[model samples]
Target: MEIDPSEVQSLYRTLAGAVVPRPIAWVSTRSEDGVDNLAPYSFFNVVSVAPPVVMFAPVDGQDGLKDTPANIRETDEFVVNVVTEPLAEAMNQTSATLPHGESEFDHAGLDRAESTTVDAPRVAKTPVAFECSLYEMIDIGASTMVLGEVEWVHVDDSVTTDDKLDVEKIDAVGRLSGSLYATTDDRFSLERPP
Candidate 1:
């Protein structure tokens, strides 16, 4: 239980390395050659609200630039599709190391819909989608963290309730270490004092 990361063969598979409740980011991008790339990143979160920004880190692959980073550099646009329980299997399928020009959307048989403000397409089945333009991309050692400024948001009417996103209806999925998965059904709240 007290194993050091340097001593482990890989950090990702270790239970202690990846903290639970990691939010999923189903990123959609288009390569320079016009191939649509879709992949999931758990190292993702919203950084700001007033300006509306999100960040996700893509680890280096055997190749220098992964599809998501490359695509963002080329088009300067991307979509973050919120993953739900219904789309978990399909989302997992897109994580395969397919060829550079291969379309994960097609590979996973997921429907694609155009975004409102960005050139990139969104996953049609996702309960919520954020259309974003690249804000900044920073190289962090072995990985690159991309910051996206949200330009538009698409929410499924079914999941909207009382002017808020109904978490219970969204049934969003989260990532765990290894092949494990999680849901947002387990809930707790703490209210701040006025």
Candidate 2:
């Protein structure tokens, strides 16, 4: 059945549900006043490889820009932490909206690790974290698509094999419809048609 987004009563839910599984970018940023913020965005993906750019769309909230996007706008720096099965619950906790000056890292009871190149702190327990600088911010309707250039990457030795990240060693978590989440265990590979 074809459904028009404008006609659907629950277009957000419909599109979110139809998207199957989406990777979560647990983005962390620092406010201009140095207040750290963390939030998870499922509307995220890698945009380029050469310069190593990633994009995450954060929809504007009722009062205006969310803390993450606002902080990025001010500082022009952020960190994208990878969400895994072990940290799924904590990641969800960080999604809560708190006072403007409050920090999700403290709210979620997570430790902060100093980033190599950015002022924003990274999740200490995260298996992988990409320290990025703002590449651009584009307004797409109600959402702001934040593009960041990866300046430094932190990968836990346990999750890597011979200096490369091994997916088999990583138990990444993904977003499903509503409050549901998925694991990468059921993955399958296909060869390129040459």
Candidate 3:
């Protein structure tokens, strides 16, 4: 199907607009006014490894920058929580449009644990969490692309295998176009030849 994005009513609802296998970023940020905001961004990925940088884009809000972007700008810190199958529903709950000064952690009934390297708190249920400091933020069209330098990483002992993290054990979830979600249950692997 050859469909132009400009012709579509909403880009996000169209199948061809959002690429599949999009990673889920359960971002946690604290507003300058001391409000904790948590939200999931499917437009997220690891951009670099040498300095351990990750990028997530938060679409522009009608009022301006969203809570997460504004919070990161003010505090210069955030946490990226890995959303596993068990925590999928809780993560979705955080995506709701709640009033200011309200915390999604409490609303979602998720435990908030302190981060070692950043002020932002991590989700206790996530298999992995990356504590990051703001590296850069760029305004791209209708979205704000945020780059974060990972300062500390926390991995659950259960998900670690043979000194490496196991994808199957983590059971991570991914976001698809619309309201669809996917799991890592269907697996395949390939190794490059020497």
Q: Looking at candidate 1, what is the lDDT of residue 142?
A: 86
> Model 2 over residues 1-194: C-alpha lDDT tens digits?
88877787657887789897999999999988889899999999999999999999999999888999999999999999999999999999998878889999999999999999999999999999999999999999889999999999999999999999999999999999889999998889999999
lDDT (C-alpha) at residue 150 in model 3: 95
Give the best candidate by TM-score: 2
Question: For model 2, what is the C-alpha lDDT against the true structure?
Answer: 0.95
Residues 1-194, candidate 3: write the lDDT tens digits.
Answer: 78787888766656423588788999999887777789999999999999999999989999999899999999999999999989999999999999878999999998889899888888988889999999999999889999999999999889988979977788889988777889989999999999
Q: Write the per-residue lDDT of candidate 1 for residues 81-179, one digit (tens) a residue.
A: 999999999999999988768899999999999989987889998989999999999999888999999999999989988878887788999988778
Per-model TM against the reference: 0.92, 0.97, 0.93
Model 2 weakest lDDT span, ten residues long: 5-14
Best by lDDT: 2
* Model 3 TM-score relative to the real fold: 0.93
Q: Which window of ten consecutive residues has the lowest lDDT sum in model 3? A: 9-18
Model 3 alpha-carbon drift over 4 Å, by segment:
5-10, 15-18
lDDT of model 2, residue 189: 94
lDDT by candidate, in order shown:
0.90, 0.95, 0.90
